[model samples]
Target: MDTPLSGSGNLPPKPGNRPPLSLSGLDFKLLRVFKAVVEAGGFSAAQNELNVGLAAISKQISDLEIRLGMRLCTRGREGFCLTEEGKLVYQASIDLFASVDSFRDRLSSAQNELTGDLNIGVIDNTFQDPNSPLIAALRVLHDEAPKVRLRLHASPLDDIERGIVEGRLIVGVVPVYQRREEFDYFDLYQETSNAYCAMGHPLFDVDEHEIDVDVLRGCEVVNHRYALHGDKANFVTLDGQSATASQVEAVAMLVMTGRFIGFLPEHFAAHLVRDGVLRALRPDLINIRTNLNMILRHNAPRSPLVKAFATALGVDLKAL
Candidate 1:
């Protein structure tokens, strides 16, 4: 009855002629040089740091400019400066190199029995607190991972967040006045703010009743520019400027001049308070409470070192 049909009639032959995707050419050496130049602030400095000839550095940068079809730097007698494109490229290079460094660190950690690099960012005031959990955690990390290299960066909260976002810092500890949805913040500790001044300051002996907000209205106050607060209600605006000091130590030093009073975290000012170097003003007047948090990018892939550090820090990585 009908023609015999072979099983191959219904099946299509396998295709074997697909072409592979072509990848864009990238010169890692040029990228490295670009990053070095940006960091060193000029070609000569980068040449010195990289230990290369001036001509070689120049050629490499020129090649990079040609490859990207953009003028990266402006060369003149006033010294070298990055152009708009150069600025963007420099930022990109920073991120790229940071990722490469992290990758290398992870690989080295895996290969070596006990070694790795951990990049961490902390607010200046956090470390100054004698009872800070970070100090204890660092001690534990040192004991447990003795061979691991630790890199700590202390800066303002905004800079710390930028470092984390740019992949420069693996983790950050910052004061959380408001929650950010893009990052995961683990509550570490809670603290209260209080007015502080040097032992010799006039306000040091002021009575609680006289230490009201009105009294602070006319007094010179040194405010920490990076402190977490919404309203800044109790702050005494000196010269109509809100930011005078970026670090808590700077604020403390300013207060030591006996010319200004500052608001400081209870734990941060505890030692000075105990040693009679600084006194609190109307302890009841300062009622702002804030929580210190361990922040990390929500979608970042955690390496073994990061996981271990998080565990040591008493953070539940899985939950985060």
Candidate 2:
């Protein structure tokens, strides 16, 4: 009897059937090239993006199509377009590459070589306190994971929370006065803010007297615009300014000029008080206690890098 030919007519086949391809059999490099081509809108654009020669890219695409036994792209005068099969393949490629990247990030983090970009949003006032433990933790994290890049964003508490929710920020350090169910919170510390003013301000000398709320009615207050709740009516608003020096040094510089009175964390004003640049307006005034929280998306995938950074900050990720 004559031997049967293989499906591709390359050789005569045995009785057994061909084995199916596994995940490993998928050429990630080729898939990446294909994805770049689709996204770049043409072969030339793909060449520029992939930094590969035009002939090489074309050969790779042709090889990929031959291996799959299907045409993935259609080229015409208008431009390159994806066929139905190409669209499906591109979607799969997106998901596959995203998972692979996550896996690599996790592996790197586990090896304690956690090196990657971390975009962190923070309430500008959190760093105002000179004794803020968060600052110390950041320094330690840098010393340990020097390869990890840190991007600091300063915004209002509401804006910071919004950034975390919309996936712009990987993490946020904010006051948890307005906790929402959609967010996960890690308690960093508790801070107390007291009203303060310039040393020579009239309110600074008020003692043994119940300071009338009217006294502050017309005063120009340099408010830390991020405070969730505070005396709102008495202030000439300088909104969106930070009360924290370490994070918002420019705002602090303005504060140092003694042109405005504002609420400041007690720890932040100690040194400035000693230097007589600022002083408490009324030591007996109402104090506001706020919890400093590390906020992240509730449903966000926990990456090893994020966990490591949280650990360094004394946050129990398990509880979160």
lDDT of 2 by residue, 1-320 (tens): 11111123322333365456454444677788898898667788888879988877777776666555557887768778888988888778766765665787888966768776676887765576653567777788898889878877877777777767655567888877677987999888887776667665666666636465556554556655456554444433545544433333354565556665666778777777888767665556545677888888897888876776798788898885
The 0-to-1 C-alpha lDDT of every candidate, in the order given, reads: 0.75, 0.69
In TM-score terms, candidate 2 sits at 0.56
Best by lDDT: 1
Q: Cα RMSD (Å) between model 2 and the true structure?
A: 11.6
Per-residue alpha-carbon lDDT of candidate 1 for residues 1-320, written as tens digits (9 for 90 to 100): 11122122322333466345322434567777887787567888887778988777777777666556568887769899999988888887767766766687677667764465687998876666654588888888889878778989888888888878866678998888777776888877777878777877887787767777777776787867767576456455446744388777788889888888888788778888889888887777655677888898887777777777777778887775
Off by over 4 Å in 2: 1-101, 109-112, 128-131, 208-225, 230-261
Taking all chains together, the TM-score of candidate 1 against the true structure is: 0.69
User: CA lDDT of 316 in candidate 2?
Assistant: 90
Clashing pairs in 1: none
